[model samples]
Target: MLSSIKRFLIGRPLKSAELGEQKLNKTKALAILSSDALSSVAYGPEQILIVLITVSAAAFWYSIPIAIGVLLLLTALILSYRQIIFAYPHGGGAYVVSKENLGINPGLIAGGSLLVDYILTVAVSVSAGTDAITSAFPFLHDYTVVIAIVFVLFITTLNLRGVTESASVLAYPVYLFVVALFILIGVGVYNIVTGQVSPALHTPVGTPVIGISLFLLLKAFASGSSALTGVEAISNAIPNFKDPAPNNAAKTLVAMGTLLAILFSGIVVLAYYYGVQPIGEVTVVSQIAEQTFGRNFMYYFVQGTTALILILAANTGYSAFPLLAVNLAKDKFIPRMFTVRGDRLGYSNGIIILGFASILLILAFEGQTEQLIPLYAVGVFIPFTLSQSGMMVKWIREKPPGWGTKLFINTTGAVISLTVTLMFFLTKFGQVWSILIFLPLIILIFHRIHKHYEAVGDQLRLTTCEPSIPVAGNVIIVPVAGITHVVEFSLNYAKSLNPHQIIAVYVPFEREEEEIFEEKWKKWQPDVRLVTLHSPYRSIIQPLTRFIDTVVHKASESDYQVTVIIPQFIPKKGWHNILHNQSSLMIRAYLLYRRNVIVTTVPYHLKK
Candidate 1:
């Protein structure tokens, strides 16, 4: 069922050879590594407004402080994570840091938290962007599922082609976003400062009612502070950066962090000065954009640019989530499958899984950024806290002298991030933070369970002596329906065993048994015995399986050993492969459950 679901979500797996065909440069590196941080643009405003909705309306003014907080936090996170890149140039982000400094369980917590965050990142970013887009196009109002799937499928295809392919495709749009945001926010803020305000700016920005106390204010700050959720993707994707990984990673981190700060901070100021109300308003962003450049062309351009950049923010999850999964898998905290290179060598399976899960989230949460925000912040902040904690431990352990300079920065960042995390847990606990706790605990418990299972399996597993003469050479018993194919191969293998006796068993379904017997007699025969079993229901596996048990029982009673040869056909095409007998599949499963029966697949290829 899981396999079927994976197929439906990601399409078929491609050969590893295909994955070897792609590579990355600076331009492409930016795409994969910069996406998560870029995606922050979509919901940063919404998160700010959401927290302020219930508190005093003056909470909206806090958006500026929170935006500044994000910028400061983002800058610290980038520099610290740059140290992380230098410390461990390989990608894997928080999981790597925690695993190296702490342990596997801690690593699993980091990985699971990041994984959930990635999924929510895509869902929230896309949904928030879709909300903006839907305002402009009424037809998209209810087609969220369609839009989400299209986005997922398109991203999956781009990823399949390879990381470089998707990055290149996204580069221009990301650049466009950078320019558009810089321009829109810049012009809007300029207009506000210059007193060249539009008609919408004529209304009161919002009436400041001061009812919520300082505690509520701090909680609200924590809530709005989630704008920095994707800030750490740069660290995780450091390995994907171009050569001189430390340099490139630091440069990229600075670029992303600086740009994000400007955009987030500018938008906050522009909205504040221009009366861009976010809460209890219909199409707040569109209202602001339309108001900014009232001309049809410029207004449409601003709105379109904002909407596209927000939508593209999902590219972050698409690029980094898989890379993080790959790291966890390599560490053996997750399944080995996560570590295996996909056709694109890009952790393609993880990418596809995140894509679908995000879409499912979009559908389940109805694409509401407000609804998914709680689930989103919980996972992201856990890792942020753990990562910083781990890094602090590492820095302390290493006792690097220069670290004192940045100790205050890391110190403040870690404390602030941790405080926000505690606030987030306390604030969002009832809504959907339940998922965050459940998801990580599940991953933690699962890793523990898998370790237990592995230990037990290793204990129960028996080591066999390879090709040792077993007191006596076992009787080689093989069943065949045809001549000159698997039968020939089986006969040759039986000779290699040099068994006490070679027994060829045949199951005849029709009355032509007599004729078939004569034909078998005429065929090349080993210096052993041949037995034929009759099946009335035209069934192959069950009867053969039963006969094997009988032979094994007989051999044991007579103080002998036995081996079974299950013939397998080498199918050239997929359809022919399925049509061929599946007896081998069933018989292998059955025989492996018993004692002292060596079952083997004797493959025979069809002649061209």
Candidate 2:
């Protein structure tokens, strides 16, 4: 029944030959992998405004420059990752790149950082999406965490179904979001150019401006850089693309980068020109939507699509995290279970783990975007630094064609990424120190797993042994509670082995009971010897185990084999088994891990 349910939900398993059928074209790959970075236009501008406005209205003017800085950073990363795609076409994310170039310990750090970032991507994206819903309809404000968790589960199910299917399903929402934003940008820009102005709603720009400083500007820029979180996802999943996977992936990266730069810059421009400020409940994008197209269908359309794209943004993490986990597992840093593909050729275990982690973050923070935002950029930048630095090392060592230019570009990316990593650590230390704590623990776990795999390899290695000899004596011992059908079944099975000797042993709590059983067995004359042992303490497992040990020792001394056959009653119904004592289970448990000792079970099924 469970298999049937799994088949229905995730579909039947595809053959190995069907892998190409699951491969995505450039369009679908962009939709599946680019949603998270694109969705940042929804909240990325707002995060910047939230930080800058704390300083002053004058700082609001810096929004454009800060966004431009983020844009420049995005450009550098895109170029760096394009080189990464070509260099490691088998899908090289930060972990693989770092492991190959920077060594194993650094590689583990990159993997751990990416894992945390993926979880935060889901949590922050869902929380921000829920905020979009509550902004449109205030009634849902209380149920935000629950709604976010449901969205996580829903996306998880879609992904588990198949990558191509989920991408096709999610494409329209992304296009809608793009269309809606373009309309908002076009209308808002035209209004500003034609000298049209509308009264500010709720409050004006920065209300009471505070004193601005260099620290305040850096904080604002760091906040805006959240827009760059999902940029590496495309490079991480190059194998999922069609033939010429590297070229297709690189093209998609450029397209996604273009869209993000336009939407993010356009939104910041419109919000600034229209005097939009971060107000309670209402998002900057929503406020900009209202300004461009009033509270009409178009406004709701923009808001609805924004909420959708934000929620679907989790799909980017879903796509990348599983593949990253598979990479880590291949290196024995994580459990091998993550490397197993599901019926639909997706990494099912990684998808489910990502879902649960997101749910936990959402519940812990109560679906608050502000709280999640601080924890976001730290995880992202760690990998960015490692990936770019790794690429720098690769170019210097390989020195392939165009090596000089590539080396310079990657070095620049490394510097910028490392600078930003330290900046986030310094500015957001209070909110992000948990990640610092988690990295060491993850690396320790990786070492422990590596040690375990090495030990297993050593133990299971084959070695030459002497040839086998025939006609060795076999000794069989059966533990009997009473002369019942279960005992008879075990005795009959023992005789079939044609052993040199068979001993039926009974350990009894009382002398009177033992005598009665002996008399009955003698009358039956079953042609098997019966040995009675008395236990003063009435511990059935101990006496039975000692008897088997004595037999094994004597057999080993004579180059003979030993077998302990125990009989168990099988009930037709599960509940019926609880009515009987499980002595056979106890015997099996005791004999486990005993080298060269064989234990077998014979079952006698009882009629209901």
Model 1 scores a C-alpha lDDT of: 0.71
**lDDT by residue for model 2 (461-538), tens:** 665254453437889888888878888888989999999999998998999988988999888746889988888898
Please, what is the TM-score per model?
Answer: 0.83, 0.90
N/CA/C clash count, model 2: 0
What is the model-wide C-alpha lDDT for candidate 2? 0.87
Which candidate number has the best TM-score? 2
- What are the runs in model 1 whose C-alpha is more than 4 Å off? 1-28, 55-59, 198-208, 279-283, 444-471, 480-498, 504-547, 550-561, 568-581, 592-595, 603-608
lDDT of 1 by residue, 354-412 (tens): 87788788788876777787778777877887787788888888878787755666666
Q: In model 2, which range of ten residues has the least summed lDDT?
A: 199-208
lDDT at position 252, candidate 2: 97
Candidate 2 lDDT score at position 389: 92
Alpha carbon lDDT at 410, candidate 1: 68
Model 1 scores a TM of 0.83
